[model samples]
Target chain A: MNTLIFRTIAPFLAALMLVFSVFVLLRGHNEPGGGFIGGLIAASAFAIQGLAQGVSAVRRALKMDPLGIAAIGLLLSALAGFLPFLGAMPFMTGLWIDLNLVADTVPVSSVMLFDIGVYLVVAGTVTAIALALEEKETD
Target chain B: MASTAAVSPALLEQAMSIAPVPPEHWLIVAPVLVPLAGGAALIALRHRPGAGRALVGRLSILLLALTLAANIGLFLMVVEKGALTMVMGRWLPPFGIAFTADRLGAAFSLSAAAIALLAAIFTRGEAGTGAPAYGPEPFHLLLLAGVSGAFLTGDIFNLYVWFEVLLIASFGLLALGPDRAELDGALKYGFLNLAGTTLFLVAVGLVYGVTGTLNMADLAMRLPAMEGVPAVTLAALFLFAFSMKAAAFPVQFWLPAAYHTPRASTAALFAALLTKVGVYAMLRVLVMLMPAPLEELSLLIAAIAAATMLFGGLGVLAERDLRRLPGFVLISGIGTMLAGIALHSPGGATGAIFYGLQSMALMLALYLALFEAARLAGTPDLMKGGGLYARHPLFSGLVLALFFAAAGLPPFSGFWPKALIVKAALDIGAWWLAGAVLLSGFFLTVGLARAYMLAFWHPQRPPAPVGRGPQTGQAALSARPQKLALTTILPLAVAALAVIGFGLFPERLLQLSGDAASGLADPAAYVGSVFPGAKP
Candidate 1:
């Protein structure tokens, strides 16, 4: 049955979401992937968890509150945007400090940090909403 | 470590001479904080009996008061300064996150906050006794955050986030209500809005690709500077997204279906506040950001606006459901605002802002009145409710006042803004638009009259033992004004007084909206503040 396939494939899909979400979030600064897409992927993973299991089971497993995570993510993302200002750059202007790494120079900017903030937001918001609706239906 | 982006310390210091970022702009943070923290606190105290309601009520009131104070303070400050723009981080204008509070955004956000404040009071305890009331507290907070985000966000992509935030909150509110009507309406409303939001996201993505920047004021400057298909495509996307919100033309069926589904007071807030926020966004972007494309697409937009106004009014007239009538009326009013923009004059645009406020106030009052009438009649059917003056003189009288105010009779808050818009149309040689406004006004009059007749003038059918029905037409008026507590009455009173106050002194808000309009027209001040080194 389709439900069986969905169940069997869900864990793999969730694992893929975790990997892709992080990959997208990391590459957002100069590449195609970013916070929003990454967040969607994570939320999809939670949704699959709900679909594969049940709302109560998934809520117990997650433990953390998703909406709270979203709020914090927004705050963190906003904080990331404010980082460039200490140096008198504009809001959200990227700041890169070259670090000596294993082979070559590594650059980390505030925008990358901001992207992570967004990824957290997306994951938190979507998952929270999905879980709430699922729980409501069960009741 | 506190980085320049922590708060616009310098700007805040210069403006207020206080701790930077003025509490108002920072007040934007409260919605994000309160409910989330409150939700946690609630979860922690779930074992406690009779505790959550008091806590939630206190928190909701406290935060709403703070939001009110922020808006009032921000308005006073902006009035003193002529214009206000704050970039989130020290990031420059074109690239950084910017939040601007021109008079229009400030005023409307203030209006919406006022509506939510009263609505919160009316619905606060209605969620039913004990922990985990009706809709979740976190849900309400997100709704507040979403509205604040829309009002403050300066970029197109950011607007999408706000819309998503609003949608999610709305869905939660709708679904949590849990009734057949609410569920059916919620499913339709949710799916439609979700689809619209997805389209909006795609549009925002396309806009970023085309402009390489997402800040709205930045887009306003750069978009006009760009040319051809990409610009047109972005314009199309923006139109599609905003139109979905405005509920104009063919896309508006869901509003009528859903606006009446919630509890009457809840419906009042939705009818008054939510969709206008969309109209507000359209007013901001269409006029400021993509004016050139606006010109190219003016006729198309104008045609749609005309269709929205006329057709929506027809639907209102045809609808027998009193609750459903206001939904259509609100859409038609949006059509008028759109028409003003299409006329493309400062006067027209200014009228649009004022009329937008009028429509919201009128719709809220009307819904409040209609809800009472429905309760008295034991159903929402307009035909079922009649001859109530003897039974409830206070309710009947207030409903009549609300009807006139909504109908745009003179000496009420609703008339001035509309008169201004009509005057603007005449000034701009928009005879057709002017005519449509008048024609729509005529039809709206008839629609309200129908309610007046059904509820007040017509005889109520006689009750067998319980109440009356077909042809028995006698009435028992409730002796007093329906018992709206002080908090409930306060918003309605404030709104009614505004209608009267503005009717007397149209110039008070008029000058403010006009100043905001002028500030919007010149991109230099906004750009100069954000990107100090930009080519402006």
Candidate 2:
């Protein structure tokens, strides 16, 4: 499982998957992909890196504890739900803001923020579990 | 296109009927959201050096206090305004997730929050300064959130989600200890509860398939009118699933086996709140949502209730472990509440709700008392322990009061609910149910008296040299008296006061319980609250 070819390609594969995950997360507002699926993809990427470079390397790369990341994601999602309170609206109400860029308009919404939070939560939790399992294997 | 046209008029009417929510309505959700947000924040701070156990415990206490206040406010508002409903994201009923608070939900949520706050304070005395990576505070808050959500949610599917939330948190709390017994207990608890909730989910799916709505109020309205929908079978499935969760009758094996394995604070919280939530769900569904099926199945439920009462009482008498005794007491109390449900009258429902509330506080206090008693004696074994009153008279008195309450003796909180239930049973000509209730109470008293005599009154005897091991001798010798902490004493005192207060002057609770029962017996206001202009 730890062959030279596999080890060499894993980092690049993980990087590509992480990028693809973000793409899926961003496009989820009006498309087939969303935070849950994106998070799964990112979690798989972390698992791949853990398998290739070891759990310690992945932990060091993340710089934050995976559970901390999950916690922050939960906070972000909850805050997103609270955003409508400023406008005297009920909880979890979506408020959209369209950004006028140099060449195009990009629409951002609290719903999108919520999706990103969900993605981070899923990715972080899965990575934490996977890393723990992998470390147990090494032990 | 034809279908769209066909649905457009009703959709438009529903959309137009959506009213702007008042600012005060947020209180209904605050009990749930505050804990979730606080829990997440606590977890986020888990790795920080400054976030020690003391800090986390204080934060948890503050958070739970806030939730309890919110619940009280919500309860008051519901009492004043009748049932209150808040649909998420301004969606109409039958499509949106609804948080509806009637007398029963509001009162139960208030009790849940109060018990949670007390449990949080109890944990402060037990928590050490060294903080684990995942402390119990966050999970505690998350568990409260789940419970409050379960109590308040009007959507059946949302209730399932809340159950899962609490179940996950409970599993985390159950396995937090390093002992193998904790893990073993958690496995059994987790497996049985998961099976219960899975059945519940399947039933919910079938309900939606049949009735085409997950909103409880809408189901209540539609279920009776719908013909050839197997409503009785669906009701039976619901009762079976909830009965499993409630640890009633034959399905109750998991509770006593697992509840005693957790640390005392966690165990007390579970004893106080978990099965009560199951009972609350049962009452809400069977009584309010599907009355016809409940009437049809009253006999079966009564049989189950009687068996649960007898078995739980007998288990209490035969149990040796002090920690496990409270679990059986809890099960026995649940049986009494089920008898109330079986009576299927407003009086019966009132008795059930009142008994449930009393049991929640009593069970929490009882478990905490047992934990302290075990610590004082240096062992949890009933036969090996004695002479608690000789050392801590005040504490022993408190434990006695809680036991009397558990036994449904006179001049305690437990007596009033028993009287209410027995009277309701007699009124309905359920002589056997009334007999079961009285007989179970007697059994419980005897069981508890034997426990109290062995653990608190009887003189501590020297260990027998021949059969008793040296470890037992050492344990008895090493029983150094420890001073009870103020944090521990305060919660126990508050619980005792509540039991006595409610016992002496039960008129208020009786009236509140009666209102809750009436609301269940006729859910016109409950449905009307959810859909403002909908016909009952």
Candidate 3:
């Protein structure tokens, strides 16, 4: 599985997939692509990288522990849920803001933050599990 | 004029009843969100060098204390104003999720949070000083959050989500111990509980399919009007699934197989809260949502309760491992609670609720006491345990009080609930059930007395001198007397005192349970709280 051609292309493929994952996550508020699917895509990308470049390379690239990332994601999601409280709204009520650029208005919402948190949690947990399995195989 | 003629009076009433959200509405969700946020923050900080066991332990205790306070406030609010509801995201009920707290839910949540707080304190001593970063603390808080959510959720599907949350957290906790036994037990617990939740989901689906709604209050309004086989079948499915979760009678094998393998503190938390959630769900669904079906199935439920009590008591008598004994005792207590549900009277419901609350405190106390006693004895096996009474009179006395409470003796918390159940049974002319309740209590007394005699009364022989032949590790460990830590004793003593205090002053709990039961029997207020302005 660790052929020269695959090893050479895996990093660029993984990078492209990560970028695509972020796009998918960002568009999820009104599209079919969301945090869950985006996270899955990124996780699959990590799996591919692990398969080609090995576990250590993937681990070095990731930097933080996957579980810690999942924890931060959880905290972020919880914080997003709490944001509505500042406006005296109910828990999990979505608050929106419009970023008025010179040429266009980009709509942002607490819902998006919540989705990103979900994205990180899913990606981190799945990557952690997959990485653990891959390392176990070599041992 | 035509539009006015087309509208129903109930619809018009509901339209006009859209009152502004009250200021105290946030209290409805606080019990759930507080622990959830706390758990997430703790996990995020878990890898930091400063996040030691002591910090995690105190943080967990504080989080649970906050949850308990929230629950108390919610309970008071519910008591003062009837049921309280918080519809998520400003959406009306029947479309949005609702966190509704009636007497029963609030009381159960309060008891669960209190016991969880006590368990956290007990864990402080059990985890020992300077242990590695407390990985399980976050899961513990998360578990309580799930439990609180389950108690408070007003939507059936939401209840399933809470069950999953608690189940996942429990899986993490059950697997925390280093022993291979922990893994094995976790597998059994996980598989069986997952199956139970799947069954619950199927039941939820069927209810939604038949009734066109998932809001429990809406279902309560709609279910009774629907007739016949579908409703009864749904009730049976719910009963079977929740029975498995509650570890009652036939599906009860998994609990005893799994509960004894976890760390004692984890076991205590499971004992106090997990099955009680199942019982609470049963009370809400069977007694509140579908009374006709429950009545139709009362004979079957009563039989299950009787068998559960008998078998649980007999299992206790047959068991030798001290750690495992509480599992059986817990099952027996569940049977008593089930008996209350089976009776289906206001008195019966009162008994069930009261028994459930006391059982939570009692089980927590019992497990903590046993954990300490086993530490002093150097083994959990009853056969090798003895002389605790000679050396530690206070500890022995505490255990005795807990035992007395467990056996439903007078002047202890267990007695009142059992008495209520028996009277409810005899009032309904269910002589056999009344007899079963009494017989089970007797069996429990005998079983616990045997445990006390074997573990505390039987004198231990002096340890074999070192350097003579080969000394077994158990003997070497038993040679040195183990002192009870103050952290350990303080929580156990507090729990014991709470049990004794409840037993001595049963009036307040009795009144509360009575009100909770009456509220279940006639859920007009609960339904009104959910729908706001809808006519009952």
Interface Cα root-mean-square deviation for all models: 7.0, 3.9, 5.5
* Model 2 misplaced stretches (Cα beyond 4 Å): B1-13, B16-18, B127-131, B463-481
lDDT by residue (B388-443, candidate 2, tens digit) is 88988999999999999999998999999889889989997899999999999999
Rank the models by DockQ, top first.
2, 3, 1
Span of 10 residues, lowest total lDDT, candidate 3 chain B: B469-478
- Colliding pairs, model 3: none
As for lDDT, the candidate ahead, 2 or 3, is: 2
Judging by TM-score against the true structure, name the best candidate. Answer: 2
User: Quick one: best DockQ, which candidate?
Assistant: 2
TM-score winner, 1 or 3? 3
Superposed Cα deviation of residue B404, candidate 3 (Å): 0.2
lDDT of each structure? Answer: 0.69, 0.88, 0.87
Clashing pairs in 2: none
lDDT of 3: 0.87
Which lDDT tens digits does candidate 1 get at residues B96-146?
Answer: 566776667777777666666666666653423222644445455557667
Model 3, stretches more than 4 Å misplaced?
B1-23, B128-131, B462-481
With candidate 3 superimposed using the best TM-score fit, by how many Å does residue B505's alpha carbon deviate from the native?
0.6
| Ranking of all predicted structures according to lDDT, beginning with the best and ending with the worst | 2, 3, 1
